[model samples]
Target: MSDGNAKKTSSKESFLPQIFYNALLVGIMAGISWYAQKHSVTAGEFVGAFASIPLPVVLFAMVMDYLFDTGSLYRKVAGKKGLTGAITALGVAGFFFITMTWLVAGTITMNFSTITPVIYVVAGLLTLLLLWPKTGTTHFVLLYYIAVQLITKFAHFTLLGGVSLG
Candidate 1:
């Protein structure tokens, strides 16, 4: 095969793995949530609740988060010549919070004070560890797990009328 064809084929092959990985992550999250809900609610109720959620909204929120994160990281790594890194990071953080709040609507209440310290500590540790060499994938997976937890909590609040705030 020509060099151009080989490059195209390699990129296409790489894309499939990423899609499969994301699908697997979603499936695992769904399975765990289903099992937890099944113990408290009937199967029909669980199905109804799951079916009521707007998939597009959830996907859009996730995609926005992913994009903001990528942009912030890119700025930090490639645009470090000035205050661009800090500005981009702050903007991305604000955007993420705004997007998450919009996605949840008024269905969930969050007590930021109660969780702020824990979030800071965990985030700090993760950031430090992720800065170390060869830890990017592991840290990303951990972050994804945190994202899944938040998603599950939002789903519960929206679908099952669960109290999310302490």
Candidate 2:
């Protein structure tokens, strides 16, 4: 590729999004504690901090897959049969968490436990949504997952720390 194109591509892939995400996560943690203090004495700062952990959460999900016979994730979910639906849901959620973790950590020091609760809530919701009696439409499942992800993350920040996203 030409030097001009390379430069343009590099500029487009700037670290703005990554920096923004980190700031947002930290803000959420602080907000969770502040919000909780309004109602109760404890700010729930620990919960907020723990919610930021991602490795353990991903690890637990992997273990769950092994125990539940979620082998060959691709084949099982390709046809959307039986437990395959649930497996697919888990795989997608897992991938998101893992990607988010790597983006934030990026070889720097990190506190894994800080994100566990958030991941736990997300994975739990995904599992439940996948297991629920299907409406025969995958669209609903995907929508449900997205909705749950937003709601849970919001609640984790607000209720736990009184933190506001905006």
Candidate 3:
């Protein structure tokens, strides 16, 4: 390949790792915040909660989230091409469906009775409608992931006063 082509490929490869790193960082921060909120009995106990979470659990959650987001994006963009693609798409969709169900159920148990699992399912379907033409670009996936996280956290705070473990 020409030097110009090589440079382009290298740049593209470099961009993916950066995104992965950023996702990992975000996941860790979210995990720590979740731990603090769940374990604290008072404001003073919040800081101590960080040290108590097992490192493996934090890493696992972050890694799982990162992989799920990546896989979902891949399925959205390329999973219509062949049999493998179809299987991958199905797997990714199934995983997200289960995850959203659990999230909705958990949030509901935290006293957010008005927010049902159907709402989350509908929101996800709407997002898919918006993303269909866009082909699941990395930028779009990242933004969507962050938005979901923020919304989930906000709901937790609003409904439970950020104190109760759901």
Candidate 4:
């Protein structure tokens, strides 16, 4: 029974090793975003590159933070391990937000540096809600993917949304 209980525990033991892997991937992606900010030539070019990444991660995380539950609410929170996982997930989500927001801002206009921060400021504000205990998602792999999409959707509107890849 103890083994079964341990298995049922979410976001802790299973996720710890994964944190390093995901963090490394996120770090690489962040570097790519920085590269895009500094090196990309035109808004259209940037748009194409930005749109190339799979996304809408933000919307998923929002749902997880607010609406997602495995009927696991009855179980006690997973203590420090769970907190670590959530915080790591939060950081992972943050990188996704920054990278995609920067990319999407580039899609809107080449003068993205000035506006990117402002856009994600709102994103950051919205992300704060994840602090609530409601965000007990078991899967960080998808959250990792969803973060980029969230920021993309937030800033897209018509400007970046319809960016012609031609």
lDDT of 2 by residue, 57-159 (tens): 4344344444333445433443343344445544664564454444323321355555434333333333433322232234443343345446457443222
For residues 52-78, write the lDDT of model 1, one tens digit per residue: 334444444444434434545533532
**Strongest candidate by TM-score:** 4
lDDT of 4 by residue, 1-166 (tens): 5887877775466566455445544554565456545554454444333333334434444454544234442122222244565565556457645554544443444554555433443334334334333444644424543454355563432332333222
- Write one digit per residue (lDDT tens) for candidate 3, span 1-166: 9999999987775565445443433544454355445544343232222222233322333444455455656434342444444455445545654444343233334454454433343324323422233333334433433454454553322222122235
Is candidate 1 or 2 superior in TM-score? 1
Clashes of 3: 0
- Better candidate number, 2 or 4, judged by lDDT: 4
Error of 1 at 53 (Å): 8.0
lDDT of each: 0.41, 0.40, 0.41, 0.44
Q: Find the candidate with the highest lDDT and give its number.
A: 4
The C-alpha stretches of model 2 lying farther than 4 A from their native spots are: 1-12, 43-166
